[model samples]
Target: MPHDDVTTPSVTTEQNNQEVLDVFGKHRDLASLPVTENDMPIGLINRAIFMSQMSKPYHRELYNRKSCIAFMDKEPLVVDAAMSIEALTFKAVEYGEKALADGFIIARDGRFLGIGHGLQLMRVVADMQAEKNRQIMHSIDYASTIQRSMLRPSREALARTLDDAGLVWEPRDVVGGDFYHFAAFEDGWFAALADCTGHGVPGAFLTLISSSILTQAIEQRGPRDPGALLMAVNRGIKQMLGQLDGNDETPGSNDGMDAAFFWFDNASRRLAFAGAKSALFVLQPGDEEGEIVDGERMGVGYVDTDLDFTWQNRFVQTQPGSVVFVTTDGLIDQIGGPKEIAFGKRRIRETIRGSRHASAARINEAVLDQYRAWQGHHRRRDDLTFFCFRVQ
Candidate 1:
């Protein structure tokens, strides 16, 4: 190889082959070497074939440490530098030694330029995967922006519909897995607080799927009833699960959303609530102790219901001045303080109760303030979401 030859790998071809053998150990069944001609890969020699010659008593003296091109078998499979890590993994198992070339040749316009190690090849693959994910997340963030934009109703509409409404949401990542939405149908306002399985991109994707399904159900059913809403969403996700059969270990595949949804009829002042694994608190006016409505922590999705699932419909009567708070576990699960203790449900309750003098928005803000103070640190471990409604 020429000294200035960038096409020649920095390490000698023998060293490159030895390094691969070192990483894979003595398992010829696991690795092989590539043969090339005219700067192009031509064939492969697997470990079994290698050992057949190497084990011969006179093998070393016969070849005289010649060029690698002489040992290559006639036909081989070649992978381009642009192949995905996931794709490459499959190809490794699929094509065997043929895909395991000396090193993936880095070429431009059919001219050999450089070489990439297997792990370096995988990293290149991973970077491409991450870039694809980033593009997808960018799209969702845009959709999240649109969804959030649609959430803002006209002042007159709010006054006419919701009593007093506000929300507090902060994501630990670029995209959040927590979701909340309201829809007005025939009888009353339908609202939901949903927590999907994870935190970042995957979590965000599941929530978007859940959100789209829930929205479509509401749109079609015209906000029939909260119980019906939950049931419909459960069935929808179950159908989705049925369609996705290959990956059995996917998060939220076990069970989808942990949520609480309710239909609050302003005209009748009646509250109907349903849930999967979420909790709801109703703070009574002028009192620290409030009526707590606890629902099954089994949000919408497939569940091991034989393990005692009770989807009960509870009716509650609330008077004007009552405050209803819906929260995702992120707030309670925050690891804060010098000791890194969770903010806890107790702190959350006390904070909400103490902040009664503040506006709905202020109360939400105060909860965050209390969280930061309690944590004594920044960086909430999970996504935090809270929604408050005061019965005017």
Candidate 2:
């Protein structure tokens, strides 16, 4: 809103020094007085400038009886009453130091309106910016709460579902693209970790949608076969996004997820795995190196439009003390360290081999610590998620 209420003292150009001095004495708080002819402003008289002139030797005797016009500033900052506060502020700045300290005059349709104080206008702009910042922070905090709720579960319930499991989930922002899910089915347990396409709010939305689809696939179709579960999830995602009948002519929507899913059988001591552009790491006890099993080179909904969607499952015969680790690309793609290169798959393999005999909890901690040390002062490039479990 434009401010229009200005009632600063004004004097006629013909007003004598005695009359102007009387007006100044009554106002006391005014920094400047506008000198007008009729109802239009002709000039401005700064109180300090007038007082300094009066203090000069022989000056009062020379001009005390003359018209106030002799001491008034011939050119003053005069702004329109309808001018926006932003424009008024810029106009005020053009007057240099004096306009900021002594204030300026505002007129409406060539008639004197009021005075605008520089300090008061600045305060209004500052308050408005502060309020906007507060609102944005509030919205981000609320989104963080919602994202946390989707991943958090009771410790007792999680422990009962998996024999021994550890997770490292870190988001670059309050809400991010990485997410993990675990569920117990009829024959065994199923777990998954995924990295959605972007980060922050856009990626968070995709994570929610992908997680919900994965949950429904598990509940309705069961987790007996890892490959079938992933295929069902892919179809569900394609259908939901209306990409089932997409063709080469259609522009691709760069929305999908890279994920790994595993079904653990407690009775047979076997694990079945299926992935979409992700991988699984296995470390046998006492081994100096671990093996990496790569998944199909295709993302869930990012498959080629001309080709058929087919995923293959891999089976692992787990020993009692073996460890299995699954992760999103964020862990290996992070850039830092002395070389300023990516952490890479080789570092991950070495970390797992060193902790082959350690418990899942210890291995998870060790791997995350090494990652942080390697990252050093580099900014995070993406969301990270790692899930590790010990074979019972």
Q: Which predicted model would earn the best lDDT? A: 2
Tens digits of per-residue lDDT for model 2, 246-302: 444435765778889888887897988988899999887666677788889888875
lDDT of candidate 1? 0.66
RMSD of candidates 1 onward, in order: 9.6, 5.5
TM-score of 1: 0.63
lDDT for position 265 in model 2: 88
lDDT of 1 by residue, 132-173 (tens): 989988887886675455444422344466746767767677
lDDT of 1 at 2: 9
Candidates in order, TM-scores: namely 0.63, 0.73
After superposing all C-alphas onto the true structure, candidate 1 shows an RMSD in angstroms of: 9.6
Per-residue error (Å), model 2, residue 39: 6.3
Model 2, TM vs. native: 0.73
The Cα local distance difference test for each model comes to: 0.66, 0.81
What is the Å distance of residue 208 in model 1 from its true position?
Answer: 2.6
